[model samples]
Target: MANAQLFKSMQQSQPLPAALARNAEGTPAYALTPRHQLAQYAATGCLNATFYASAEAQLATVLELCKAVEPSFIAQTAVYCRERGYMKDMPALLVAVLAGQGAAEFAPAFQRVINNGKMLRNFVQIMRSGAVGRKSLGSRPKKLVQAWLNSASEQALLAAAVGNSPSLADVVKMVHPKPKDAWRAAFFAWLIGREYIAADLPPVLAAFETYKLDPAQTIPDVPFQMLTALPLGAQDWAQIARQGGWQMVRMNLNTFARHGVYAIEGMPELIAARLRDPASIAQARVFPYQLMSAYMAAGENVPTVIRDALEQALETSLLNVPRIAGKVVVCPDVSGSMSSPVSGFRGSATSNVRCIDVAALVAAAMLRKNPDAMVLPFEHSVVTCRLDAHDSVMENAARLAAIGGGGTSCSAPLLRMNSKQELADLVIYVSDNESWIDAKRSGATATLGQWNVFKQRNPQARLVCIDISPHATTQAMEREDILNIGGFSDDVFKIIAAFAAGQLDPEHWVGEIAAIDIAAGC
Candidate 1:
């Protein structure tokens, strides 16, 4: 007979490399490269209080990571997060760090990342907070701010003036942008409370000033906040609702209903039509989870038609979720920490969307696209969640999110799969990546151990870990067969599809960031 040792399973699992550090959960985990850490935080960090990290701790970690990586990498990561990941706070923070470093890429990165007034304000606030390094908007950043102010259209500027405590008006005061024309000069003067000819103001501003003085005028097509203080009737509020953009409409459904917009003839149908418009949804870059947030936040007064429209828009937004060609397993982490808001706690400003909501949405969308996919909701163990292929994605997501709230064991599902000899072409995990329940002190993470066993049976299987929180460690090391990505944007689905088709290198998420053309004109 052949020697038993020689004939034994050649695929016996080997010990993994020693963990480089501990995760937020105080468990042994691999440390990400500086660039990878920066990318992870940039994509998912909101600079708020996460379950595992405080706002102060997150800020310090981000600054340290920025120092370790090349300034250019920071710039690229900022652009990648803002443009592709559709993140807001973290990208602005990265750009602020670049400004502090005085890198050559700062100007272009600022121009690209600070695309809107809110973002510009964020960058200015971060600079002035002295968190990154400087406490003042130095000459370069001030110049860019001035340029941004000069370049914005009159309507855009008016909309930008809605927020306060360093609002657009405050930014104008800081930058003292030189006016290019008489209208701008008059507008700047009016913005800062200096006297100016009202007629010289841009059309929208002129209309706004007139409307403010007399509530009888047709509500100006300015931001809704600008009109909220005016004494207006239901019809006036209806007109404002009619003029609101897609995002504005989605966010203020309850407000619109409260203001009697739905009571107006034909208003509900028109708004419903707008809500379901595919082109507008794509242009707005609306995430499915965002629509889910809107849907859940809508009050009883919100129109049924509008509620149906939100569901339709959610489906339209997820049109890019790929239908994989083979067996797929989606394991969503339903641990207790996932109950915290997706954007982290920021007092009253925290998002209503929870991390688990996004994970469940992703898993549900995948199941909808691939009707044969298996969904396993896990915390310390595989929690059974029954989902139907034909059920609405939102309903299925709610079901999956309702199950587990125990300690995280990222290895639980994989171990279950190994025991059952499950075959899968792709194993997807949507989690915070703070696994600790099954962590090892001197060997590979239990996740890696189980994955190795699963790989022995299916050599070509690929694992995709979609982290939805801001953290700097992972359960499994990145390799040719593994991908670690962050963020809740639907763009993630496209990236997953490309990776599953072998269109990306092992560098995966970081390679995508590294490939950004930072030198390209903004």
Candidate 2:
């Protein structure tokens, strides 16, 4: 004898949409458009083997995506990824594709995307590898490379020399850039192994040469790789640690400790102060997850004072994490695949931070900002993880990441909320978006169905799916209420805030990429 209106409200009112494709785990999922796929790859892809895709597979997919989209879209995506996503390899690869296609948008996009020496090397290497059609840097690309070499400052050029296999010297040999000044002329000659006046060499390069010739001389203020090959004492390592930038110090804390940088008198306190400096952290654009990595990787020999500073740095970096209004629920996917490195596996170059670590960090960060928020860690089902609202983000994240390694069920958390009749204004999911265990055979995905059921109780609720891997599928379709974003960068927080506030258009993430001003010089 229930009221007809009430009974109807309890049932799903809208027809569920069918899943467009299968995920890496053979789960029914909604596929992203070609542009969306490219953006997703550009943001999170590291061109390495992932849990579901091999390096060759990812590369082939990216190349195919470049051809599927418009040349202008490629340019915009490159700019957006480089400027806002803070990505490296993917952006360079995109530019290489544009160059090979002979697209007119290539020049300006190249100017924006190739902003550093490492990027220049990547572009050069990708072009010459014939991966993007043309095997060599053609006239336009060669001119652009020459211009970059000619306009670079002495310090930038020296820093560029730090990496190799197609080192700055190799690049000089390939492009043969004409020097604009005596210092550049000497530097170019020195790099390419030609006769040049040592006195005319830039001050930093001259100092580097002097130190290279005599280990007793003072360590030159060059890239750390430029000095690591030489035998250095404790005092020498300490000096390098003191002079290194915030990012360098953050990444090499263990190296510093191994070489006795931390054992020196008062060096620990000095390094600790630098680590916690707000201005330095901002200037370095330090990602919050990077701090987590540093904290977890610090060796026993590392000073406790420095370790504590890393925690502080993480807190500072998370200042942008939005404080959502009303009831909030954070669902972190702790599936077995998430145990893989967040940046994908690259042999020795693989990142130590797992995808689960980042998922937990995002959940913990949200809880830290919204104290009353509920955290649900899920794999095949909801995992029991009791977190303290008063606990540190690091502690809570550690607790959440330590649980759940079963198959992924993206609907588990939503279904749990539905069973509890929980009303939430916001639900944030940090996952890889491969929901095989709960995937539906027909109609909408199990995730979408569960979301609809949950929405029946709380129609005002908004869902943000933050994909931490480079995949082109999701558990739920993007609508006015659902948002899909990629990458583990802090920028994801800002995008989430804007979407939750109803500031984005229907196109959402793709619109954001399209809005990038690639027409400035085109």
Against the true structure, whose TM-score is highest? Answer: 1
Clashes of 1: 0
The positional error of residue 309 in candidate 2, measured at the CA in angstroms, is 0.8
Instruction: Give the runs in model 1 whose Cα sits over 4 Å from its true position.
Output: 1-13
User: 450-486 in candidate 1: lDDT tens per residue?
Assistant: 8888998898999999998888889988889999998
lDDT of 2 by residue, 21-130 (tens): 99988878999999999989988998988888988899999999998999999999999888777788899999999999999989999999898898999899899988
Which residue pairs collide in model 2, if any?
Answer: none
Off by over 4 Å in 2: 1-12, 213-217, 519-522
| Models, CA RMSD each | 2.2, 2.5
| Residue 110, candidate 2: C-alpha displacement in angstroms | 0.9
